[model samples]
Target: MSLSPLPLGGAAPSATRTPSRSAALALVFGAFVLAGCATEPPPPPAPAIPQYTSPIPASALVGRYGLAAYHRPQDATRTETQARAQCSNPYVITDGPNGGVMMYLADDTKLTEVISKQVPGQPTYIGPAEDPAGGERDRQVISFNGTVLQLKWVDPEIAKRYGIMVYVRCP
Candidate 1:
């Protein structure tokens, strides 16, 4: 006995079997869940820091000028040749603890060798005054007015003892 052919599209004994709606829905939902659970990548790092240094003025200590003894009467006058010789030496000028300039002569083989090490490329004063105590231990305060160099002691007692000296630069 021959059986009648089942309806091709019907769920009951169809000729070709198609995927059920529940199975298709489950596959699409699984693909979206995997996409949502995936991870993102991380970010990068930062940069470095710079070093500090001082910039001194080039115009502050150049030219021919004279320095006179501020305190003592005997050491008052300095000749132009002597003044030029004094200024020709290289030295560093810094601020004193008090409100004045501290001129440190660089230790050279010549006159200032007895004082401190000579700083290269430094401009020498036409005539810069010296501290009376006369050693590396000595500190003197100086003031400049383009015309003259005024040497004063920070200690009032030392100033009274040593005195201030003014040096004039020869034109």
Candidate 2:
């Protein structure tokens, strides 16, 4: 009794049951690739800087105040009017070196005054002057005395020109 020679190149009969090793390897690689793609989101950005404005203190006024508050004994009335007129013309006030006052106005009206030392840092406009120079010359400089609001000027000329002292209560 002789068995027939097994066919070396023909298709095998349909009962194959072995698992594929390459297919298992591909499944694991796909899972690892998917896991690597997952990630956490980043954090948000920071906030903006604050803007501060100067406010007037009512206690600093001496007597009945006028349009442009008095800066000195001499800067009583006339300078007050000029300052008020300057203010009416949309003027801007700035600081100068050696604690001076720099005033800017439209149509070529500029004035500079030197007096005491100005408070450090940028100045903020409070509002109209309460003494002589009407609504026009109504400007003040920002300052602090241990957290207390103080108006300051360095220019004596500015004080005289504006009809008020270099420093005063904001109002």
Best by TM-score: 1
| Tens digits of lDDT, candidate 2, 1-171 | 976665444535447744457878999999988887885546665444222332323222221212344555575445445434443333233454433334332123555332222123644443322222212333444343422233433344454554332221222
Highest lDDT: give the candidate number.
Answer: 1
lDDT, model 2: 0.38
TM value for model 2: 0.20
What are the candidates' C-alpha RMSDs? 18.8, 15.7
Candidate 2 ranges with C-alpha deviation above 4 Å: 1-54, 57-72, 93-151, 154-171
Please list the C-alpha lDDT of all candidates, in the order they appear: 0.42, 0.38
Instruction: Judge candidate 2 at residue 42 and give its lDDT.
Output: 66
Predicted candidate 1 versus true structure: per-residue lDDT over 67-163, tens digit per residue: 4344445554543234445654423344343323444333323332112111234322221223323223243325455555555544556557646
